[model samples]
Each structure stands twice: as C-alpha cells, then as structure tokens.
Target: MLSDIRPAIVSTILFTVLLGLVYPLAITGVAKLAFPYQAEGSLVRDSAGHVVGSALLAQPFAKDEYLHPRPSAAGNGYDPTSSGGSNYGPLSADLAKRIKGDAAALRQSTGHVQIPDDAITTSASGLDPDISPQYALLQVDRIAKARGAAADEVRALIQRNIQSPLFGFIGQPRVNVLMTNRALDLALPKGQPKRA
Candidate 1:
C-alpha cells in the first residue's frame, strides 16, 4: 500500500506542476508574443490616443447619430463581467413583453413598421460588438437625419466600414458599431463633438 501510494503522489505532483503551472505559463508567453494587442484585451483608442474601449466588447450608444449594438442584458449594457442573455425562453410572457417594448421604440426611432429581430433582441453573450449589415443600413437614414448629414454620405460611410465575411464565408457580413461611430465622428464637419 505504501509503495502504490508513493507512486500516485509523485504522479499527481508531476502533473500538477506540468499542467497547472508550466502549460499556462508557456501558452501565455506564446500568446503575448504572437498577439500583443489582443493579449492586452483588444482595447481601442481615440484619435488623441486615449483608450476608448475594447474592440471585442460592445458599448451602449443611445444617441440617434450613432449606430447601436443589439440589446444587452449585462449590467445595464455591456458589462463584460456579467455577460449573459436574459435567459427568457420563447413563449415566455416576460420575453414577449420586453421584445414588444423594444420593437415599439425601434419602430418609432427608425420609422419602420417591420424591424429585424436582431434590432430588438439581445445576443446570447449579451455583449456582441457586431450588428448585421442589414441592421446597420436600417439606421442610416435615422443617423443621417440626426447628424444633419446627407443619407447618401452616411450610406457611403456604412459601406466603407462594412467588413466582409472572414476568409470570404465564415460568418455573415456584420458591422462593428463602435468602429462605424468613430468613423462618423472623424468625418463629421469641424466643430462637431464626439458623442459619448
């Protein structure tokens, strides 16, 4: 029994040191070396070089002039630490009530009777940074009106920011809302302040 126990203890310690310590350290080192920007949380910066946000996370943009991300259930919107959806299943009265409310708001703002589901629903992660291209285009007119810019110019801005499917077909075409808003701010006429 003593001999068998000794081998088991040795193996346990060996694996603990190898997998619990060495493996994580080695992988972290490789990641830090290979993708320094991403290793630091993929933060985005403003033109003046101040850190604005992480490209990987979504932010709440409530202004009409800025495009919005899908509804978020994480701590009043975009709290990475509490990332999760409402968890309300289909046919749930609570879910229906929330969607009905959001759809009403979107219809009023976008002036469209039929808005896309994504426009009113939160993503499962509750922090998706991308919106479908269709949804982004749906807001072009509203944003243009809010900013007093021409709809065609705003459409052109959206077109310029459209990110193609990864490697030509991995995911649907989507727009990163924060990136698009930043571009709009930069292109806005002189003296216009960047919206928070």
Candidate 2:
C-alpha cells in the first residue's frame, strides 16, 4: 500500500509540473519569440503612438468617416469575449427581417443598386476584421463626404489596403476595416477628429 501510494504521488507531482507548468510556458515562450506581434494580440496604433485596437479582431466603427466592420451579434456587436454567430438559419424570419432592414438602410445610405452580401450579413465569428473589397468600395463615397475628401482619393485608399487572396487562389480578397480606417484618419486628418 505504501509503495503504491508513493509512486502515485510522485507521478502526479511530476506530471503536474511538467505538463501544467513547463508545457504551457515553453509553448508561450516559443510563440512570443517567433511571432511577437501576434503574441501581443496584434494591437494597432495611431499616428499619435497610442494603442487603438487589434488588427485581428473586429471593432465597431459607427462614424460615417470610418470604415465599418461586419454586423456583429456578439454581445451587442464585436464583443471578442462572446465571439459567435447569431445562429440564425436562412429560414429564420428574424434573420430575414434583420437582413431586409439592413439592406434597406444600406440602399438609402450608399444608393448602390447591387449591394454586397457582407455589408448586410454577420460573419460566423461575429468578429471578422476584414470586409470584402466590394463592400469597402461601396462605402467610399459616404466616407469621402464625411471626411471632406474626394471620392477618388478615398477609393484609392481602399484599393491600397485591399489584401489579395491567400496564395493567390485560396481565399477572397479583403480589406482590413481597421487598417483602412486608420489610413483614412492619417490621409484625411483635417476634418476628421481622432477617436478617443
């Protein structure tokens, strides 16, 4: 009985220290050294050298001068702690109603006959940082008007920020809303004030 108990306790202590402590620390150290930016949450900063947000997660941008992320259903929108979809199926009337309302509002705002799907729908994670290039382009005129910049200038900014697909074939082209908005602030800082 004593012999068995001694081995069990030794095994428990050894495994606990090795797996619970050492393993996590080792992996974290490696990650930090290899991917420092990502390990630090990919935080984005402004020209003033202040931390604004993360490049990986989505954030709400309600101002007309800024580019907006997708419709988030995560804890009132873009809540990283509660990242998830609304789980509304295609047949869900509530989802349909929301989409219709959003579409109508978008139509009124942009006046584009063909609205992009991403502009109206929420992403699966509800924290998608990227938006389709078309959706970004759609909001160019409104953003330009709000920022007191020319429409072509705003459109060019979006074009510069548009990221190509993974390996040129895997994924769709997307624009990081946060990055583009940051660029907007830098390019047209005259009329648009810095967000607190």
lDDT of 2 by residue, 1-196 (tens): 8789988999999999999999999999999999988988999876677888899899998878888888999888999899999999889999999999999988998889798889999999999999999999999999988878899999998999999998999989999999888788888764535753
Among all candidates shown, the one with the greatest TM-score: 1
lDDT, each prediction: 0.88, 0.90
**Which ranges of candidate 1 are over 4 A from the true structure?**
none
Worst lDDT window (10 residues) for model 2? Answer: 187-196
Clashing pairs in 2: none
Per-residue lDDT for 12-97 in model 1, tens only? 99999999999999989999999989998998987787888988899999988889999999877889989999998889899999
**Model 2 error, position 138 (Å):** 0.4
How far does residue 183 in candidate 1 sit from its true spot (Å)? 1.3
lDDT of 1: 0.88
